[model samples]
Target: MLTRRTTHTTLALAASLSLAGALAGCAAEAEDSAATPPQPTTDASSSGAGDGSTDTLAGDAGTEYSDGTYTAEGSYQSPAGQENITLEVTLAGGTVTEVSLTSDATNPSSKQYQGQFISALEGAVVGKNLDEISIDKLAGSSLTSIGFTEALDSIKSEARA
Candidate 1:
């Protein structure tokens, strides 16, 4: 048997408590969002929106590579035969410090051109930003350069922060 004033006070207290609980739940959610970094998405072209949409690749995020050796494989047909290319690159401070390539070409000419191509390609790619590596020419190894470029693409995808 509560009095009128007592009943009103109880109802007001219950309403205030419910509102506080709702606010506390919302605060927890806000903290969670603030604690987690947005994950980079596979689609490099999108602007990573805040609505949980796919984010841009890490290269565009202005983040450095986590400092490691990254490797990628690429294969393509050359004038001599099918060539499998393996690119092992060392990155530091987000720069390609070393580029090592091992190419297996079925064609005799490919074997002949491997060393020369490796030397030339290393000069072009080393000291370049990992994202902007484009092997446009390698003297006499045009077909092998194509394969190398493919490997570069793979490496970029792998090395994304």
Candidate 2:
């Protein structure tokens, strides 16, 4: 009678352990199913200017427009002095191929300083996209640089219209 009772208890313990192991396996699978899938990465190349068109003084490149010249005028006043500037832009195939600057400075001191500023402008912006062009101020000619950029911006705005 005692041997039969001990065998029954051992059988019950083995059954309980099997059940616990099965429950643990099911719990792990449930946790895995609850997890989220990885998301795809975003593309950075398509971020801005969706049309893929480049900005130029004439219009977008490869377009046809009148051959006549367009003129834009602007002025800048700073602590140094006032600068009056005009830009003559030539357009071909709807692109700005050339830019010319005319400046009026009566003061000798202003003229000397403005010359360096104008030279910097001519080098930085000629043959470049008007929309993308930006000016970094020269070390000692910050005011003149501001004036030059203002004039260039006016030219860009007029050309876009």
Candidate 3:
């Protein structure tokens, strides 16, 4: 009877450990597959490794930017295919006063991520200088930033005085 009880205890412990391991694995997979979008924060230190241009426009174009809103279509390659986004920014005294993004992604996944990026864009860029507005990732969307950066570069050219 003692030996039988010991065996039953060992079997119960093993089954419990297996169930716990399976649960952990499922949790990990869920976290990786659909990560919760990051909330927009007030921290100003989340700038990405930008394209290395300062307040001055690229290629000796100088830093004098026209005070107005500019729009441009930015494109980037994604796993599904090429994706594009329309980006608009309002500038006042070389500072970003407003920002917006329109996602043109046809792929559902791409569209979802772009929507996440768009949702977080104003917090990332509004009130920043034109050259200081680059972002590598926001709202758990990294690839969308590439398209945003491209669009921002075009806007800078359009806004250059």
Q: Every model's Cα RMSD, please?
A: 17.4, 16.5, 11.7
- Rank candidates by TM-score, best first: 3, 1, 2
Give the range where candidate 3 is weakest over 10 consecutive residues by summed lDDT: 53-62
Worst 10 residues of 1 by lDDT: 55-64
Candidate maximizing lDDT = 3
Clash number for model 1? 0
The TM-scores, one per candidate, come to 0.60, 0.48, 0.62
Off by over 4 Å in 3: 1-62
The alpha-carbon deviation from the true structure for residue 71 of candidate 3, after best TM-score superposition, in angstroms, is 0.4
lDDT of 1 by residue, 1-161 (tens): 99999999999999999999999999999999999978844654455574555654444636456567988888777666677889899988778899899976656777777768887877788888776766656867677777787887777677666
Give model 2's TM-score versus the native structure: 0.48
Of the pair 1 and 3, which is ahead by lDDT? Answer: 3
Residue-pair clashes per candidate: 0, 0, 0
Q: What ordering of candidates by lDDT runs from best to worst?
A: 3, 1, 2
CA displacement after TM-score superposition, residue 119 of candidate 2 (Å): 2.6
Q: Which digits, one per residue and each the tens of the lDDT, describe model 2 over residues 1-161?
A: 56988999999999999999999999998888779566645455555766664333233333334544677666677545777767676755444577676778777766776677666665565666555456667535566656566665555555554
Question: Can you write out model 3's per-residue Cα lDDT over 116-140, one digit (the tens) per residue?
Answer: 9889889888988887766899999
Output the worst ten-in-a-row residue range by lDDT, candidate 2: 54-63
